[model samples]
Target: MHSTRPFLRDLSDSRRKGWEDGLRDGYAEGYFRGQAKVIVERTKTSFPVRKIKVLYVSSGKGFPYSPIDEAIVETLKTLTASVITAETKEPIQKLAEKNRPDLVLALDGMDRPVEQIDAVRALGIKTAIWLTDDPYYTDMTKKIAPHYDYVFTLERNCIEVYRGLGCRNVYYLPFAAYVSHYRPTLTRSAINRKISFIGSAYWNRVEFLRPIIGGLMEKGLKINGLWWDRLPEYKQYPGGIEIGKWMGPIETSEVYSGTKIVINLHRSPFDETVNNNTAKIGALSPNPRTFEISASGTLQLVDSREDLSSFYKPGVEIETFSNSDELMEKVNYYLSHEKERQQIALRALERTFRDHTYNHRLNQLFGYIFK
Candidate 1:
């Protein structure tokens, strides 16, 4: 037989390249269109608009991509403000001089050279850095926090950290899902035996989920995602499916709609630390997966967190599990109780639409910034 292995590998590589190229092109074009739309809208408005031009900076290589960027761009467009993206702070500083935006929104911390931070600050433009990861690890606030006018954190836990650094304003802002992009399409045939989990394969997650993987297979549940490839426990579940890597918004929603149960696992890196140092450093920063999964209207079995309650009512808006036994039990219960499952999904959808959206977040952040 002809060797199809190399051919398949080459085809996969070509497809991935095509996808990346398409994303870059689409982003540039969409960004320009979005900016134009904002300018037009702003021109027609009579409201006393603040002379606020915003620049959003990103390294553009991270999780929960496009949706967040798209939301920021769309918000800028609606606000009729100038927004620009740069890979480095040097370019951003140059652009700041040219555009003279009122606000600088750094997607990650301003990790560029210290001189760049100094240059931007000298321009008298307000700087706001959005921290999406654990502040304990990166400690961006410690180094650059004092220089910025405001620090935006994805979790409430980081507010104190920023305040401790003498940052004048620290706002607790969680990641939000784009409702139009991430919605329920329950028409997709539910894969009765498939139970999906979508996230990076952190070591702690693998340990916590290993036994549940076996339990799932024994009960005829198929698990999928990047985790399965690295899972030594995978040999036990011979028939389980693995849908490697992360899926985009469209594919993720499809998976949520089609899968019988979707699992949301949070990494407990802070939980395991011996010293109170980490907790004093920062506690629960639930990943964006929580909102994304819940927004998809999938029946989610998420790991418990205090923040979860703040967003959801539990058993009403969504469901939760504390350990492996609880996770497996909830999985089996929801699978059997289709009516209750649908009701919970509906409530979760409503909650996401009302409060947990990008627009809602923007409104809150702007209120604080502009007030």
Candidate 2:
């Protein structure tokens, strides 16, 4: 009655600003404090004087569309005192001899020539190769793995395989997410979809998705990602969104966050019909998307894998489906029950931050190597 609406509006605006400012200040303070702690630790341990010099050989040029390769290089830079990246175009022998790095880390050795690895190893520098595609590159990888000081595989079972290939220092280092890059920070008014799946349209995926896409659309599911350019059917998925172009890791994370459930479908690396050389390794491991989606605090509906239970408690931290029927049933059930879905997502986020991160893997590697 006394025209108090203006006062209420002003109060609301001030409150909004206060919350935003608080979040900004808090983030800045935490970041600096973390840096300060690291510096103090380094000084106490004399780590800077004895800093680990690392040479990171990246596969970015070979896999330009995927951001994970670049992310790995950036993460290594943070973990080491000095990191020199040797791209495919660079002269590896000269760079390694000049830098004389304490360690050389190569990601996916198939993209790199064996001669380059041999050249770097010739400088008496320790070399390690982290293979993302295990048995898929089994033939090529086994040929080059023995040249490295350490052989790290994403598939746990492949440790024996590498050892069988005569690599003595083989280790199991699975794919992980960078927590700082992936988090549930973004907020939205309304969810654009009840479920979502983002990935390239491999022949297996296209075949599996054809019948279910329409049903999923009826239930408000969205699908968007790079599909095979040659397949006109993938170009025009009925009712499903076609991203057309490649999306970076950040964009993928945003899409994961906006959905109620993010589906995790592993691609067949050996589908010869598609002319894709990815081998059907029958590897029992989860890919980077598993950790990335969980770290984003989104409920994930993943396919059943043997190693999944070791990482997360099925029906608790994640939901798994063995077939399309199971997937559809869970999707419908989870959509109707919001609390269960959110709880699983929360548990997964906690697990990811605690165990599944790039920092954790790097620390383990360095500790084992330097010990």
Best by lDDT: 2
By TM-score, who's the top model here?
A: 2
TM-score of every candidate: 0.78, 0.80
RMSD of each: 12.7, 7.6
lDDT of each residue in 27-111, candidate 1, tens digit only? 7434433432333233221223345678877646555554677767776655645566665425768988987887877766645
True lDDT of residue 29, candidate 2: 36
Q: What local distance difference test score does each model get?
A: 0.68, 0.74
Off by over 4 Å in 2: 1-50, 62-66, 189-191, 228-239, 274-280
Query: C-alpha displacement of 293 in model 2, angstroms?
Result: 0.7
How does model 1 fare in lDDT?
Answer: 0.68
- Give lDDT for model 2: 0.74
Q: In order, how many clashes per candidate?
A: 1, 5
On the 0 to 100 scale, the lDDT of residue 275 in model 1 is: 23
The list of candidate 1 runs beyond 4 A from truth reads: 1-51, 62-67, 87-90, 189-194, 238-244, 271-282
